[model samples]
Target: MKYIFLLLATIAGMLQLHAATVDTINVRSAQMNKDIKAVVISPENKKATSTLYLLHGYSGNYASWIKTAPHIEQLVDTYGYLVVCPDGGFNSWYWDTPKNNYLYESYITKELIPFIEQQYQVGSDRINRAITGLSMGGHGALYLAFRNQDLFAFAGSTSGGVDIRPFPDNWGMKTHLGEYHQEPKTWDAHTVIELTHLVKPKSLELFIDCGTEDFFFEVNNKLHEKLTYMNIAHHYLTMPGKHNGEYWARSIDFQMAFFAQCFQKVTLN
Candidate 1:
């Protein structure tokens, strides 16, 4: 009897996955020949407080988050909010650079956000929009949000390669910056940790989470320390996991819930 009950329970759980549907969108940018893919998930039964603009990591397409974090449906199945997962390219680092053809910053700020606002039930205010990502996309999320405060109110990064100067010669970033030695300023200016100096801190809510066992943990820790030195208030979290889908999928839930809560409206007379 117990054996039969366990088998039935496992079957029911697998069947539940069919209930949620992911709507994918592909947008081509004139800034680059490449096409951007995004997955938009909205719940119809309950009204949600805000929208979560998600970005993908290096070598990851927009499908990464949706495929890894299947539990996203349960988190807000009743709360009618928007979840958007946008591609940051194989590894563009979400930069609008002096040399690169892809101006992802412009595409997201000028094109994608407008499309979302125009096509969906999105609020125009910055408070209603939040951005976050992992690894390369984590760098992108902070870089975009910090540079364009008017577009995003809350920002978070998970295991972001925050300081890129160390890898100036490694990643294809040299092509984007035209050699680090030749354009040191560009490299310094674009790094997420280096760019932190430009942030106003209090103007936007921020969160950063990284696994102590992750390769990028040192840089992420440096970012947390620097932000603290600057007297910036942010949610800094450390967990015991590596750079993988299992951790990221779990982390996004907390990020989404926190960002959604920030966008909730309140009034007092």
Candidate 2:
């Protein structure tokens, strides 16, 4: 009973890609002021075991992963978990703005997780919660997890822009942190790779992946190298590819699979 996921709606209009088996729900992110498209898929006639916050990268919406990686339904169906995709804002980079005063860190930590737990029957503890994202979001997931260790036990980033000093004009940094050269400390202080050593999370599982051909591979590599130097325990996987939806689409599988395995260990204990 395998079925393909859908992007554009046919006459049925946003129906299940797999014949009404997996539940696709479009919910609005009140903090972000946008509607998020999410999926809750479990084994047929069964409750979900775990939940994952599957974040998308820059210039992409919540539907990016579901559209590109049709196999996500396969992952959700097999693992019996809910995939939560929130709109991180187009090119928002998920950083808490200093001047503009939009606190994404607070929103995701204080609002979203609590709201999700209340609305859904999934386990509200760290064991049943995980976060992973690509590029901008990859950095975001790690930043959020490290800052709020109690909320998410497992976290990962793929082809993440861990270091942001290189791009002063790219993404939403200009609005978030002001000009890079003018406020160099502001930009450097918030970068995930730089802040890794500051976090002494009690119980957290961390992982990262990057493509050798990707433009941001160097930053991700620096993060891996630095984490190793700091003796922080994490899983780092480097493959050969560039920055594209396809690479992220495939990377999502690796991350979600890792999260699922970690959750299995947690449930056993």
lDDT of each: 0.77, 0.74
- Which window of ten consecutive residues has the lowest lDDT sum in model 1? 1-10
Off by over 4 Å in 2: 1-43, 98-101
Model 1, stretches more than 4 Å misplaced? 1-21, 33-35, 265-269
Kindly list the per-residue Cα lDDT of model 1 for residues 1-269, writing each as its tens digit. Answer: 23323433453344333334468988767667667778888765544446778888888988888888877765545334688888777768899863657688888888888877776767767877889999898899999988999888889998888888877776688877778888988788889888777788477888889988888899999999999999888888888889999889867756765664565532110
Q: Which candidate comes out best when scored by lDDT?
A: 1
Per-residue error for 162 in candidate 1, Å, reads 0.9
